[model samples]
Target: MNVSQIKIENHNPYAVSFKTNLREYFMNAASVEGIPTVEYVSLEELKFLNSQSKDIRTGNITINPEDKEEVFKALNIVDRGEYFDNETIKDAIINPTAEGMRKLVGITDKFTFERVYAQFIGLKNNGEYDISNRVANVLERRFDEIQHRIFNTKITINEHGFKPKEDIEEIKQKNESLETTVQELQAQLAELKAMMVTASTPKKRKSKAELVVETENTTELDEVKE
Candidate 1:
């Protein structure tokens, strides 16, 4: 009953012939009234269909309502008619990437970030003012992708030992240790210098005392001779 041994014929309805036992089992399982019709689909088509079904089950991309409101407020659409054309606005709404959204704003005599955002809102609200959630979804996904890339790049750099904070801290600790060692050495040198001074002072006093004793002895010898 190895299913892999079943011969799959490449024809309309894509016939699959199993062994006698399997065939008998299928026949018995089926109602005697009518045979079920078989449909054939290509592997590629099946994969495509599965992917589509998965996406539907997962649902389309969605951005938060608060985020949408923030984006709209940032755009500041004071006069909607000033910056947008019908077709360009529609295109921006369909594909709402930063660059794509910029096109909807059109060529302006004066342009600013806020102004560009405003134009984007203006375009979305142009006809029915009913903006698609898909646009927000696209924007949210794009921003998430960008943030993820930046986070990964930072991690990669850190793995290579190129982290700024860690390097700086290590260098700082080394400098502090060096400074402590230098201070200890200086303290040791001062102690040695003090010992040398103490030792030399006693030798100088002894030499002076011996000279006086020698002078007194010589005077006594002269007196005794006289």
Candidate 2:
């Protein structure tokens, strides 16, 4: 049978045999026609699949402990409200380079400088640095805010981004237009229905006087014929 003509029959609703029939049908169809298998997945399953795919795409990452410690220390220093005149420390942590580290920390020892630079590189690669992760977090927050605004206030993101103040006006205009169209259609439909009812209903019977006149005319004609 053609794919469109194929039907699933589930006669025993209470029995588990109905599922067996469905399975057999799909298997047989696939074997005979080389049809692709179809499977239903729950939302959780779909989410897991997406996460797996993302992980595969991201691949494996290895973090160096020494680098992690140094990066953590530097971040801690900044967290304690310490300020440095050199932008190199900030730039190095975000996008570390050997030259930048040397200028920022004044580390003339080759081995020490290399170690610190390696830590910065590791942090940058893992997206664990302040610049990247902080920015991502901020953007995520903003998106959540936008979502809340959209659903609660009927605001939509247009070319200019979120316009909470103008959203009400835009929605009102659209609602008014829709209401007007609905009213016009209702009036037109009412008129058409009235016309249909008038056309379908039988005309009222003639008055008794008119019927009597017609009957008398018929009788007179009949008498003349006789």
- Residue-level lDDT of model 1, residues 131-221, one tens digit each, is 5565554334433444454222111111222223456579989999999999999999999999998887854346888899999999999
Estimate candidate 2's alpha-carbon lDDT, on a 0 to 1 scale. 0.38
lDDT of each: 0.39, 0.38
Off by over 4 Å in 2: 1-163, 207-209, 215-226
- TM-scores for all predictions: 0.22, 0.24
lDDT of 2 by residue, 1-226 (tens): 1222222211111111112212321212122122323333232332333344321111111112233233334323222212221123335446533343223344333332333344444445556555444323323343344444432222222333222335747988999999999999999999999999999999889999999999999999999999
Error of 2 at 135 (Å): 26
lDDT of 1 at 189: 100
As for model 2, its CA RMSD to the true structure in angstroms is: 27.0
For candidate 1, list the clashing residue pairs, or say none: 75-117, 75-118
Task: Report the C-alpha displacement of residue 106, candidate 1, in angstroms.
Answer: 26
Best by lDDT: 1
